[model samples]
Target: MNTVRSFGFLAKKILLLSLITCWGISGHAQEQRPNILFVISDDQSFPHASAYGSEFVDTPAFDRVAGEGILFMNGFVASPGCSPSRAAILTGRYPWQNEAAGTHASSFSEKYTVLPDLLEEAGYTVGYTGKGWGPGDWEAGGRERNPAGPAFQDEELTPPHDYIRDTDYAGNFRVFLEQRPQESPFYFWLGTSEPHRAYEEGIGRAAGKKLEDVEVPDYLPDTPEVRGDLLDYAVEIEWFDRHLGEALALLKERGELENTMIIVTSDNGMPFPRAKANLYEDGIHVPLAIRWGEHVAGGRVVEDLVSLIDIMPTVLEAAGVEHRGEYVMTGKSLMNILTSSEEGIVDPSRLAVYSGRERHSSSRWNHLGYPQRSLRTHQYLYIRNFAPQRWPAGSPRRIEDGQLTPMHSGYHDIDAAPALEVMTEQADDPYFNRYLHLAVGRRPAEELYNIKKDPACINNLALDPEYEELTQSFRERLRGVLNKTGDPRVAGDGDVWESYPRLRGPMREFPAPEWVLPVKED
Candidate 1:
């Protein structure tokens, strides 16, 4: 019996070895292992590109990619925040499954294997330029390099505006291509730090962009300040897209365009008060376009739900590499959805998608996390906030050096921007108070919304008797999946997320809410 078991184990190992050895063989060698160029923009949201019919911003490069390949309408990130969302994309797992890597600005554990490391082992030359898997300490996590790859940021260029980054992303990419060996295939990550925050006021107008072209979201007022902010965001989006066009042109100049797979998307949503950190549609939904030349069909629009984490497995499969890690991937490959001739809903089984959040900025007392999990389908959206007692954003005002700010002042979770500043200054006004309430108000544990009717997620349907059954069904489905995936939130260890040390960002002190008194011990 012992001999038979030994023989079976050895046979399995040999079969795996044979599969790995066949990666670069015969006619399929170069054809199967195509180069990967992944371009990511910071804080851009869905329907922002010209291809998506937005009149505000013109993204010719993104449109060109869509014209030459597939355009996705239902693509989302794993988290609403940057660090954890990037970590999830690299590891191909949910944020809750990865220990410290799952939290914002925390160290990533080396125990979890990332896509670049796995591809490097499979003989692919991997590297990255600009911002990659960051805003956190990767070195403290025991990684000798950035999880994305080696750095190639030796070049610089003067940006159009003062707030924009001077890192010449396109020039750096060209440098990387020049340095790479001719015979070896490469995986390059082009992460652009654009459209994030602290925009030079009225720079968009200075650049000849009209404020009237900006389409304000329903959650925000249609004031000039809001329109100006949106225009500035649009300007930055165009800047990033311009670099993408240059990179695509470079690939064409080198005759690698046809064989290379180009993926263009963003890390998270726009940097607005309620959009970037909240689990609303604008927060999680992002723009996505892919161009694979002749390997995949062009001018295709797909409506199937896809997650950012799916990129890890999709790239691995494209390189003819197999996954052999301890942690399991929660995302499914989009190869079938991409290769099919159909336009929308190629996979009916992809009925719903899931997303979760751990911690964003250090905006609260004790750095406590307002953990949330959500489920999105074609018709409806459901969300569960674990700590309903805690403020959804942060406290109204923070304390410093024995000074006190007035009521409705803090809301630190919301990023500081012109629109946010306007909302804060005009909080007492009748017209702006409703919008302000939506951005920083507390709520029930479970909230539901009809996305088709309320894409902004302003109305809560969980307590509506008309949709009681539907809400209950979605709530159970969300909890069941979390339990199945061993989510700590439902696995009796949800508090572990709060225990993780926040290694970066300022730690602000906030007074206890005037409403809640201290609990007395028994």
Candidate 2:
């Protein structure tokens, strides 16, 4: 009887030990799941961040992220405009893949899945502050919240400029963290609506920024007006960076810094003429910095091309989630690139990056877009203008309420600003005519530029005899990828992009340009 009692005690001890070991393993798995923080700024371009040695903007927070992890030199967005760019990032697909969401001021379809939605399904508490997936409506798609996530934008503060919004982005992030379940990880999108448009006149100069300090791009005139506008742009960008610093501090204080993956980037390029709405280097290229604490090595600069669409797959992979949907993603995960210790061209397969633009604003005939697509290689940029006859910057004049506006008055594609006004006023001057032409001129069907030699894209090489073979090769490659990815523009159903409903914003009428007036049935 004594030996039997001893055996029973031994059996109970073994069972208890086994249960504790399983619990430990489960906790270890939880620890491996890192929280994600995606920070995006509106209307910002690449080479503007301090890490890239730009003298214009001071982005210490972005630099901090780069110092701790990696700075991507060739980060490109799917679209040069805001709405489609955000849609592409959220859905992990190109803008053309999303129905109406592919254009500006349209609706997002319910068919495609977004990053936050997928992360939520995998047990993450998701939320967003400031700008998210918009300039478009998400409710029309039967979505419960913005595609970025739920809102956390209650807090506000007085802003330095009337153009700048007052949403307390960092404070809202803290609220999100506080309200989340202790055991569940969180995914937050801190999108800032800074550096867009309607900036306070002379704000940059008022802030003591020297006009000489502003480095004017070759496409714009180097006058005090343009320089002052650039300075004001810098002020707003810094405001976005300030909030980023606060958020980083909050995460560090909560002891969640090392366990979180932080990604910093922008929707597109700066809100300047010939930059924001075009497919040039300044329009599609954007700053990207990532930090994952001990998970990634610090102070690495990668030159490989990466697109914004990759964000969705990278986050999904990090959380061990699989995208098993019918709407396939064309982007590959950056996990391999992120984890690698190599600096330049970590992935040779990333030979090039692509970007495009559809209807950016209501600035065309029947709301028609200046449809353009581009392919950027290590040394060259190739552009294809589907409708070359349409005014690239909208018709030079518009008819409103049965009245015709004057010539050189309705280049609505360029955002209304002091710099734009200055350029228009000086358009006839031989000295400034070239700058005007670069901004509002009608483009050729095909344009090729050696990006290294002409970053501004002022010189076209498509018709040059020396670059004929290279131009043909790029054109073929671009078309092949577009076909493989099921892009409608290449699939003989390109008109469907125009068929998408513009659910919001005011519509305007445009008079046909001289090139198309002769063909008009009128």
Candidate 3:
């Protein structure tokens, strides 16, 4: 009997040991998950970072991230406007897939689950600093906080430029770190409001930036005013980089830098005419650099076409969390590309990326949007403008306080800039008129550009007989994807985009077009 008792006791001890060992393994696995530090800039473009050899802008922090990890040569946003672009990033879905959130200043629907909330549920202490998920009202969508995360913008600083926001982005990040539990991992978003608009004019010159060093895009005239404006833009980008550097320093100081996956990018392209609100190359294409210490191989440049929507799935995969949302995510994960040791074109299947825009600003009669959907490959960019007759930019006239505003005073879609002012004020000059028309001109129903040769989108190849077959093929591909993804524009509900209310921004009045009856004001 004593011998039998001993055997039972030994068995029980062995079982306890096995349970303890399993617990240790589970704990270690949890600790191995990396932290996420996503940094996004406002209104900055690709190839502007010094890592890409841009002459005018100096971005040591972005360059450092690219040098230490990987630089993506082809990174595009789902939309050109801030609200929809950011919404597409937060949710792993196309801009149109997210109702209300698909357009500028509209409500972000609570139905679509976002990255931060998902991470927070998976034990990550999520929060954001600076700009997060808006120009739109998240509350109206029944969300209690910004879709990016809970706010950490209590800290403030004295900025050098008047246009730059006083929010102390790095300082707030420090506060978030202190508030997080010691054992829990974190996912923090560091958004910069710089380079958006209202830059202190000529601040770049004051900071010793020469106009000669600035390379004007082909679409814009090479003039002193335009060069100076671009330089000022560079100054703001540098400001954003400076804060990013500080954030990195904080992580290093805390010995958390290596365990953190740092992602540096922008919401959309630079806020320039023919760039920001348009569906052209410069409008949607933005810089992207990812560094995860030893996890991601350094000094690699990838040329795969990637969308900002992929960021959501990538973050979820890195965290080992499964998406449990009801809505389907349209973006594919970039884990394979990110982890692979290969350089260019890591994923051969990633051939194209899709982007679209709707109701960027109250630009047309009855506040109608210049709805456009596009398909971009390495060699070509195909765009289908739904309302080709309507002005791509805002109308030439507006009514304010029951009085008619002057012509050229309307194009509010193009953010106020010295370059735009120069083109408009000198519209009579043959040199400036061409650029002015390009900035706010009406587009065709079908537009295609050979992106490789005409990156500026100066030449439209859709009308050329030689490219007709190629254009048709691109159109079919774009339509196929839109239909598969259930895009409202292609799903017989294209008009639904116009029905959504503009939750924010001024509602300007424009005279009704000749084709439509006058809209009565409520």
Candidate 4:
């Protein structure tokens, strides 16, 4: 009996060895451990995918992922904006823990631990294509190489594309997969630049997307133009989904699909006004799906209060590693929930999911930003904008392709798009100007919304005397989370802008405020 058992164990080891060589890597630590294939999408909102019930576009690949694994309807980002959210994911710590990484332009510090660095130390071959954790300082974070993996050799690998075409993700992923070692288990992050701004107009229409099929959210006016724009965004999302499909197919062909853990999610919400930069549902809420064949139950929906920060811990746990104390990380591993028949490990409505934004770019000289802290529960949404004086859309700096026009087609805030046009015209009337307060005008210290009833958020219940009690409750809740999480907004009096640094990007000087004289003027 002992000899038979030994033979069976040896046979399994030999089979594993054969599979390892095929993926260009070697054997893993254990049979139960699976390689992580994380896919991150940029600027995608939950409402854009069919799995989350988006009327705008059809996401077959994303749906396929959800159908084959677990779909998280309540997935959210740690920050309303990109840089901070990503920092939280990679560091396994809140934005607050990441020093300057808390806000945009606040660089990530090297003293902190990082995901790729940690995984690489554990003997995983970590290679990333598309977007790696970014929009901040990875080099300063002690990530000397682009891959930032422990196994990274600067001469052998290059940083993934900073400027990426929607379809380029698959090609980069292919290269990463082809270059990996068969014996070494891998962790590959497929960051896709999709559904972000600067997309070709009419792309969705070209994809056979009907204008009528798109559901215009209440924030934007329902019009052919807006619908068309949304469809265009959908086209890019579908493009991203195709990349996922291609990667999955390759994994299957290599016989590593079953042993690979897949996580598909987006960085933040759609890049639209009152959404992207703001701490609204459209800004923070996102779609997420996880699949680990024979491990995570298929066709399950977990409506839990999970944030992007949780992803790092979950990945560590999935890799058969334990994250012990002494490291103050707030993220929780969802491994048990994924593998179990449990409906939802954590209640979606149990706690308030918090998000805030700091300096995004060097719109101003002093790194002034529309800092805000928000909490979203099952019913209500609360926001505390620290810099009510600063423009939430941005500091009115002309961006070339972003907020600037003509040469770049400045798209948001003051754009002539149908939605903005309609809303702008509405401001002409006294009623709408007040309503437009929700859109652009200066907000109070606290803004509250009952999302269940007013999804468009045209009304601010904070000022309404009748809803004062509800508003106050949300305010207290927001403060409590801020206090517990050590968010600067609570004690900083929500003045996060005072501490954040300005962006030093190429467009820094171009968008310099008119009030400031150029060097030539001196």
Candidate 5:
């Protein structure tokens, strides 16, 4: 009888010890997950950082990350616009797949689970500073906090220029570090609302920026005003880089730099005419650099086609977190490429990446949006504009208080900038008229550009007889991807895109299209 009792006690002791051992192993594994530092700038383009050998802008922090880890040459965002681009990054899906969240200033549906929430569920403390997943109403979408994470924008500082945001991004990050539990891994988003628009006129000139340093794109005129505007943009980029450097310094001070995966990129291209809201190269192509200490092999440059959608999967994989939700992510993880030592086209199967837009601003009649889908490959960029009759850059006229306003009073799709102002005000001038047309011109149903020959996307090869076959093949490829992705535009529900309400920004008025006119009584 005593031997029987002794055996039962031994069994219980072994079970309890096994449970305690499992708990310790689980806790240690959670702690071993690397921290994530995601830094995104407001409106920046690829090849702007000094690391890319740009003469105008100096970004030592971005350069540092590139030098220490890997620099991606062909990094593209899912969309050219801010809200949709950010939404894509958070959800690991295309803009159109995100429903209202896919469009600008629309609701982020509660159905779409984001990265920050996933990280938090995996025992990671996640927070964000500065802009995070917005210019839209996340609260209206039933989210209690910003999609990026909880906010850490309590700290402020005097900005060098009025257009620059006063949010002290680095300082806010410091506060976040202080408040974070010592044992937990963290995910922090450092978003900078810089180089967007509304720069102090001639601030760059006042700061002793030389016009000679500016490299003007073929789309815009190479005049003093444009150069100065670009310089001011460079100044803002520097400010963003400065804050990034400070954040890096803090991590180093805490001895956390070695264990953190650092990602630096932009939401979209520069906020210039034919750039920000357009589906051109400058719009969707963005700079990307990632540093993961010893995990990612250092001092390499990759030229593979990559999208911001990949960021979500990369983060989840790095943290060993399973993506659990109703929807599956469309983007594949970059872990294979990051961990590989080979540079320049690490993934040969990554043939092309896709980008599209619905509405940028309330720029059309009845608040209609310009719907476009594009497929970009190594040498070519093919675009399919669904609504060819509508103005590509919003209508030129607007109705005010039930009265028609002056001609050229609109074009709200283009962000108001000194460069745009010059183009419009000097539209009558022979030299500037061409630029004005380029900025607010009507686009064909299909457009193609040889990206290698014309990165500015000035030459359209879609209509060229020599490229007709190529264009058709690209169109079919785009269709296949769109259909596979369940894009509404290709699924006969394309009109539903325009029906999504613009939840934020001013709703402008324009003359209704003929199709919408009431039939006359005979």
Candidate 6:
């Protein structure tokens, strides 16, 4: 129960989450409260940054943030997948409550409270650049806050669809700042698109990156191709960091850094197998750093377990604003933690931190996913695969044009590793070889791992007799929360999604499963 804070016995688990988990929110807001620079990167992993001790790619800007403020070593996203993770960060509610935003293709419900909108209400100007609130739309929920800001009147700029030059995030951010209302405290989300995907192969090599400089995750095999791909990923990461540097430098040049609370972190785990789309540490764990001048002590590293939902409550606290009682927020400020005012975080009794994924990428048919849920704590991590019968990635079908069709094929953790690459490539037919065990393989419905012993989560302790004690406890913990969260399947169970009026879209028409697809009558 070593956590930031915890509530007493509540029904259905009371949406257990922690504030410490949300990345960013470093400095003191009072000194710098109204001016908030929230920067988020897509699909970047913790191991890529030098601040976290990555020798491969040097992220001086990211490291600078950590150096100037506080670096959270135990930060986690409520839901490891993107859409839901963003929803939790903004709304401070678990994905199940934000049902519309729960899945990849689904839209975020307008009924939820978005942080930017609240900040605007509290008299702060707000706007965003590049990859604001998506993978899906939020307009369907009947709210017109496209980026959900009453303060969002400035020009809107999104990142490039394909690679481009100076026209990326920083340029668009400049446009936002130039158009911002005069003499008002402004909140801007500088979301970067540098490191997501579709990089020109060997792009990093051309940039003078060395393969030996690459750091490989234990889950993936060490090989030249994997290292090279990692280097390519590193190049993009550096590009993103440099953008952050430029933004910080701009704030300083404009006399804003000292009074600006800068919060920077990634959306979810690295975009790799057993990482991005899964609920393992590699998926949910992220790097977090924050800075505030003369208030939040610099050079602090806290290990208290925290979750994304706590963001709203913390930011609200920092901004000297309350939740208005009309809206119930699930997060608390780590202000005390940052200031080291509290002796030690009370066993926040974070019964567990939870995450799930509904869909990813273009291949899923019938919208049937690798559907999964997981719970993480200091001792162990437990996962429940709702649809163990389905492939984690889309099935064994050959993707149309690119390597990305098989989503797991390019996972940075295990993506393109020599073992996976050669094993897949040399096979007679790509349809069977490409996806292989990475997807479409049968798996146990319940999995338990000793997170301390196996951080990568490679060992399945659920079925092992030696770990039965650990398995039972973890299973019970997950079941209690899921049932409390009103997950239908666990309670003799039904689908909570069934109670929800399922949103309709062309996404529902994903290719039908082979068994269900009719042989063409033609």
Off by over 4 Å in 3: 1-29, 517-522
What are the Cα lDDT values of the candidates? 0.85, 0.86, 0.89, 0.68, 0.89, 0.65
Cα TM-score per model: 0.93, 0.93, 0.94, 0.81, 0.94, 0.81
For model 4, residues 1-522, the per-residue Cα lDDT tens digits are 132343344345445655553332223445455788888888888867888878766778788888889888888887766677887887777676566787764466666677765665555666665666666656655556543342211222321222236345666556556656565567878877676666676777887889988877777756676788788778778777878888888888889988888999988888765677667788888889998898877888887777888888888777765444445578777766776776664443347567777766554434456677788877778888776665565443344444553222222322233445455555566654443455565677888888789866667788889988888888777777778877766566445446655443434423554455566753
- Looking at candidate 4, what is the lDDT of residue 94? 69
Model 5 weakest lDDT span, ten residues long: 1-10
Number of backbone-clashing residue pairs for each candidate, in the order shown: 1, 0, 0, 14, 0, 13
Two-way TM-score contest, 1 vs 4, winner = 1
- Give the per-residue lDDT digits (tens) of candidate 1, residues 1-522: 132343244345434634665443334543567899999999998989999999899999999998899999999998888889999999999888888888899999888889887776566667788899978999889987789977777788888788899999999889778766565677899999987887888978888888888889999988999999999899999999999999999999999999898999998899987788888999999999988988789999999888998998888778777676579677788888767778988899988888888878777777877899999998888999998877877878778886767776667778888888787789889788888888887868999999899998888999889989998999899999899888999999999999998898888787775446687789
> Global CA lDDT of candidate 4, please?
0.68
Give lDDT tens digits, candidate 3, residues 1-522: 132343244345434543443221245446587899999999998889899999999999999999989999999999999999999999989998998999999899899999987776566677889999988999899997899887887789999998999999999899888766666678999999988998999999999999999989999988999999999999999999999999999999999999999999999889999999888999999999999989899999999999999998898777777787588688999889889999999999998999999999998889999899999999999999999988898898888887878778889899999999999999889999999999898888999998899999989999899999999999999999999988999889999999888989988898878679767789
Task: Choose 2 or 6, whichever is better by lDDT.
Answer: 2
Residue 272 lDDT, candidate 3, scale 0-100: 91
lDDT of 6 by residue, 302-389 (tens): 6667777776777777787656454365555676676663322433654467776655544355445556778888778888887776
Candidate 6: where are CA atoms >4 Å away?
A: 1-32, 148-167, 324-327, 341-351, 398-423, 427-440, 488-522
Candidate 6 C-alpha error for residue 473, in Å: 1.0
For model 2, how does the per-residue alpha-carbon lDDT over 1-522 read when each residue is reduced to its tens digit? 132343244345434543553221234444577899999999999888889998878899999999999999999999998899999999889887887888888899878888887776556677889999989888887786688877888888899788899999998898788767656677999999988887998888888878998878889898998999999899999999999999999999999999899999999999888899899989999999999988888899999999999999898778776675769787889999888998988999988888878888878878888888889999988999999988888888889888888878878878898878887887789868888888898888999988898998889999899988988999999998888888889899988878877777778888765665666476
Q: Report lDDT (Cα) of residue 154, candidate 5.
A: 74
Judge candidate 3 against the unseen true structure and give its global Cα lDDT, from 0 to 1. Answer: 0.89
lDDT for position 91 in model 1: 91
Ranking by lDDT: 3, 5, 2, 1, 4, 6
